[model samples]
Target chain A: MENKSIEQLNDICSQVRRDCLRMVHGVQSGHPGAALGLTEYFVALFFKEMTHNNQFQMDGKGEDLFFLSNGHVSALWYAVLARSGYFGVEELGTFRKINTRLQGHPATEEGLPGIRIASGSLGQGLSVALGAAQVKKLNGDDKLVYAVMGDGEQQEGQVWEAAMYAAHYKIDNVIAAIDYNGQQIDGPTEKVMDLKNLKAKWEAFGWEVIDIKKGNDMEAVLAGLAQAKGLTGKGKPVLILLYTEMGYGVDFMVGTHKWHGIAPSDAELANALGQLKETLGDY
Target chain B: MEKTLDLKFTYTEKKDTRSGFGDGLLEAGRQNPNVVGLCADLIGSLKMGAFQKEFPERFFQVGIAEANMIGLAAGMTIGGKIPFTGTFANFSTGRVYDQIRQSVAYSGKNVKICASHAGLTLGEDGATHQILEDVGMMKMLPHMTVINPCDYNQTKAATLALVNHEGPAYLRFGRPSWPIFTPKDQEFVIGKAWKMIEGTDVTIFATGHLVWEAVVAEAMLREEGISAEVINIHTIKPLDEEAILASVAKTGCAVSAEEHQINGGLGDSIAQTLIRNNPAPLEYVGVMDSFGESGTPTQLLEKYGLNAENIVKAAKKAIARKMSY
Candidate 1:
């Protein structure tokens, strides 16, 4: 697929937001908050940022790879992967359904084309990405590996372990993004467990931190991702502190943690869909 | 009656199974460039020094983070590299079970999880380090091949075989210096039982460090005018059901011995096979639902009923029960 302009990517983002809401609404049991929150990041990544192959292979040898560490937002990833030609866009209808490739969390068991690892269990994706990046370095592939994790996932100790490992090994060929949505399932992350000064924490762990103040904005997301890509192949892993809303495009679900995992009702779905534009055709 | 036993097995050298893993990893790396080794701060203990020295670029020292090592190994599989992670059995299975389940087993990644210091034979570390439930934990996971080779030669062979097996696997070994009796040139076929001694009275099925105990028990039973068959069951998950049923059909009773818990080890697997296929009197020789303490390997084996004397007693009990039936 050809690289799209910011205006075109924004149009796709709106469509992806609609797809995320409907996919969650269809099942009446999927995470919509993070999915809606990271729509622009997903759009910027698949549409304008990363250089990848649509023809998927398990061993993504020469092409850049992405791992969805916070797999709750799988609705958004499924939408992006389908729209980006990994699979038919119609498969979005199978989200969270029985015998569907799009599991509640992203999985590779059903041979999902774009999914490299199963990750609903948080704080593991970074290590996996680092491992893949090391392999690429060993094979002289020169391709970068990317990963995304939720702000709440930072509380996991394995995440810190991976953080220390990346810096200690000088694994510089990978980029990681934190979906800094303050709200989690139980409430605000600050109240849940304060991630005091997350930027300083990552920087102290030897990461080149890049904060995208407006992670929901398409231009900001694209620029931040591009900068992260540029920072790769240096001495330390790059991190993007992406500040996104819990539910960016929706009105009622925007600020609270209520929409984190709960699905929208028929009436609520209509209201959420009313907020997001049907830029491209829905599945 | 004709002579029932003509040949006796003997070992001239003793080595820890961990050394076999280290040698096998070096050999596997030499054979396949895609084979990579990852250790979580147990390089010398796991005997991975040779592999690290040989393939410094391919070797990864992931500090003491077993979970990260597991995830790294799983990720390494995405690039067509066969990664073998080394750690203690406790850290390899219990500490990082969810990591293995979500990243490797559920994803169906081809990562070899090689664990040493398994079972009570991990002596002196006590219960914290000894993981008797690893085989059961690994075998329960879908797409995981559980292997517990008996000796140095067999461990080496199993490691080499896993290089081509192409899926998630758990290779469990121990730290004790054990007798190396299996032939050095023997082919280690996963899921196939090796019949160490053939008899008609009782079948003694064993795995890991207990196989040598079963061999000694076979000799001890032979001295008592009792012909006992001894079989080495290496791969516990894809068990050689045919060999087991065939041996039990001829022997009429069975005895299971291992350096693991009685609840979820080789004995449990064998008991399930028998109750479902061939109902017969079976006696178990393993650690009863209990944790091990700090002791020498020999002392721990004797106290935990994991030695040849216990195996012989269990064989007699099983034979007596079969006779009464």
Candidate 2:
């Protein structure tokens, strides 16, 4: 699975988007908007960027750890983890249901391989990642820690708390990214809580910020994540505010706050499935 | 049992339980390399300076951010590090209840939430800093072990005991210097009840600072010709039901005392236990549905009816209720 071409990662991203849609469609519930938006980033992370093991260990001592702070996109992460051999891809069928390891939010208690923390509650991932990064430093495990957050989650006070902590402690081993989709549950993040000049905000918080113009583009995501990786260990945490649509790949669901957490109906599902070509067979 | 009662109870000094937590934490750090301390800008208040001084690299000063401190502690546990987060009881619970619930307890992270300056005895800082509802808040969370250790030695013992116990635990201690009783080198158990005094007229259940009050109440009750069974209920969540029921069965009545709100403190746990298993007469000695204010520890205890005199009054009421029944 190493040395993958950009085209190959893009193909994986298409299949991931399809899996995310199908999982949500099967349940008739789950967040498909952010799941679709984060498809390319997840593909790039699981396939190329992170140095993680498919056989997940709770104490991720020597591996590069990834925490999904914006956990509404569990379907996408489940797809990515499964496709990357963390578990069978078939388990994606149990995305949100009773007696299933794949909960509505990501949890480690159910013996889920990739998930180390239960994160549906927003704005806690960065702090968790910072703590893990500190442990990595203490253990002298030069491996990096990665965290992905939602733009709307910035409104949570704890995020700023963590931001201040990372910078003040000079915890440089962590590389954080945000899906700047500009939409949240109630409405657009700007209308709900304007995070005006998000880049400047991160900069003011003492983080070395990277702005990705096209977060949904596989090549751009890969390059941005790679650049984020390179920026580590320079005495400051790195944050990549990657610009992405509310929903990508599927035409009708794209660029709107309405689809943020809504599952597609049969007709809508058909339209979505048609646009997202299944490169890998569906679970 | 008779031999236990024969032993003379005395203390040479009175010390703050927070200092015991500091000493115990320093010892824990020395004993285990995995022990890590995090303070939310209240290092001196929590008495965590020694642990920070000795293990400077392992200590994290989270600087007035209690929520982030809890989140970071939860995260550190993923790497097999036993994180001890130190803060005032108010900030540790009420301020960061959601964070502790989601990150530590719900996630089943092995983090010890060490809280100092609990209850009305937090002194002149007043109602804002003092948290009377932390016991209820923490105990309600699944996988959260609630402990309110009495006095200095018991607090130290509870601190050391939590390191060996797995899962998320809340250790509540205090700011003001109180009488140091319990044996300095005694073994501390997590869920087991410490029967401080044995009797049959009535049962007196207490925790934290109020345990000393209950002991005082015990002597007062004996002087009044009523033998009171005094039990130190340090572990609040895993309420020693067997010990409680056994004591209540022998006494036929109970009096619960704590330096917290009456609605959701050690008294409530005891009532719940007795009501379920053995229906008995009970009296509560705590703050009666009101907030605390700026006062000295002694003034606050007396004003709030959380002192030895109050416990003695509650015991007599419980005893009278039992006779009426």
Candidate 3:
């Protein structure tokens, strides 16, 4: 329950980014682009923001719930979960391997800590978070539920339906963040589905919307999250559109959908490791 | 004579399965504060108005979005709440399939997906609403317990039972009322076969609305000197293989009837079980490979060969196969 300082949070983010890149490299399979990209946010949730224990109970009683809607970025969540004491730090090496709880996607059946629902399939976590928020209110627990979805995943009709439900039910205990990386697997989000006027759309659906630079800045993310937490129990829900690079920390992996689900070659791993500091040591 | 069939009352103010679901929800709510009801713009159609009206705090009216309803139900299960989500079978299964796959079934959540308007009996709504493959779709999920109760009382009892059962479930029923034959006191247990009429020749594995039809066909078969046994196979997934094998061990032949497609429904499950264990002479009495059309419930039943006559014919044929085997 100890909230980390900005420096400590940044150090954890550095280690998480290293583990994420290694997890993808070790498997010779995974999506390192978004995983390395969302390190700050995931680290923020585990080390600083959310009120959750490391016991790994699927249904954490009286605790906050966080759902990874864009489940491909599981490396970010998995690494953060490992360092935050959900599981042994050494278990990060087993990610995406045979018979490991750290699956390519976050699955509750695996009994992994910090994961509530299976969300590999896009466009579902918002509704799930809303439901948890509602249950929290019913239990009078006053705990908040949070979810993150991809910008491209916003094209799903169900996302809007969940959005409307959150606003209509006045689900202020829930906060939804969009990973506005601007790129999906095929291409840029704008080219794929064109989420033109994203702010107006969230506003139209009765959400208190905010745009944040989510890839690098911890202070900005903390401020946005603080704003979100402060707006809880209000009439309207909050949606923070986080502008992040597809592959934020990694240099070579940046600027293309080619890194969406590719594993780095041995040579590529060397280059990536050289760029990223081994702050927490390799798993 | 088919054994998996039963019926008695015919036309006394037949109530929709949704009404039974609603009544059972209200009762469950009274008994357990953890029992919760969720609806997706079909609070009235799913007959959850009573629960919604009485326990407004526990009732979640998630408007017009089936995907979100399933997701929310999955999430509610985290806090040890027994959530029963109400919607049409089509909306519950096909519309939000991925959502159920991830949040409910794969996650192993203790949520009840109580779906109404299951088969062709949905009527007038046509092919769009008549989800004949719902059973198959639901049964395919890993941790999902699939059940299709025969009538109003049965659906109600099953709904109440699902609250106590741990893990995810799909309880499917129909929009219209048929035979309300089972005793109101009959205990509803998942994966247990109910023997309506004891017979010796053939076993009829029936579920949902067709359980009543199998009962009627038992009478018809008796008129022709064939002793048909009717057994209700309410729980399709985690099939009651023990009961089916027991009935088939006695009868040596079987007929399966349902208001669903022949592919991957109760019949498919029974066939798989029989082939592995009993391997009895079997004939299917459900729909062949066709979509439903716009018509009354009776008309659709007759047109799609889902009536008592079809069950009778299938039973006779199964007995004949048994004799030859």
Supply candidate 1's per-residue lDDT for B265.
83
Global CA lDDT of candidate 2, please?
0.91
Superposed model 2: Cα runs more than 4 Å off: B1-8
Residue A71, candidate 1: alpha-carbon lDDT: 94
**Candidate 2 has what TM-score?**
0.98
lDDT computed for candidate 1: 0.91
Task: Write model 2 residue lDDT over B1-325, tens digit each, in one string.
Answer: 2122322366779999999899999999999999999998899988899999999999999999999999999999978899999999999999999899888988899999999999999999999988899998999899999999999999998999989999999999999998888899679999999998999999999999999888877877777788989999999988889999999989999999998899888889999999999999999998999999999999999999999888889889988898888
TM-score of each: 0.98, 0.98, 0.97
**After TM-score superposition, what is the CA distance of residue B285 in candidate 1 from its true location, in Å?**
1.1
- Pairs of colliding residues, candidate 1: none
* Poorest stretch of ten by lDDT in candidate 1 chain B: B1-10
Q: Write the per-residue lDDT of candidate 2 for residues A1-283, one digit (tens) a residue.
A: 2688998898998999889899999998999999988888888888987788998898898899999999888999999999999999989998898989999999877889999888989999989999999999999999999899999999999999999999999999999988999999999999999999989988999999998889888888878887888899999999999899978998999999999888999999988889977887888
Which one wins by TM-score: 2 or 3? 2
Error of 3 at A72 (Å): 0.5
* Candidate 3 Cα errors over 4 Å, as ranges: B1-13
> Between candidates 1 and 3, which one is better according to DockQ?
1
Taking the tens digit of each residue's C-alpha lDDT, what string does model 3 give over A51-152? 998887766778888888989999889888888888888999999999999999998787777788888888888888888888888888888888999988
* Comparison by lDDT, 2 against 3, better one: 2
Backbone clashes for every candidate come to 0, 0, 13
Candidate ordering by DockQ (highest first): 1, 2, 3
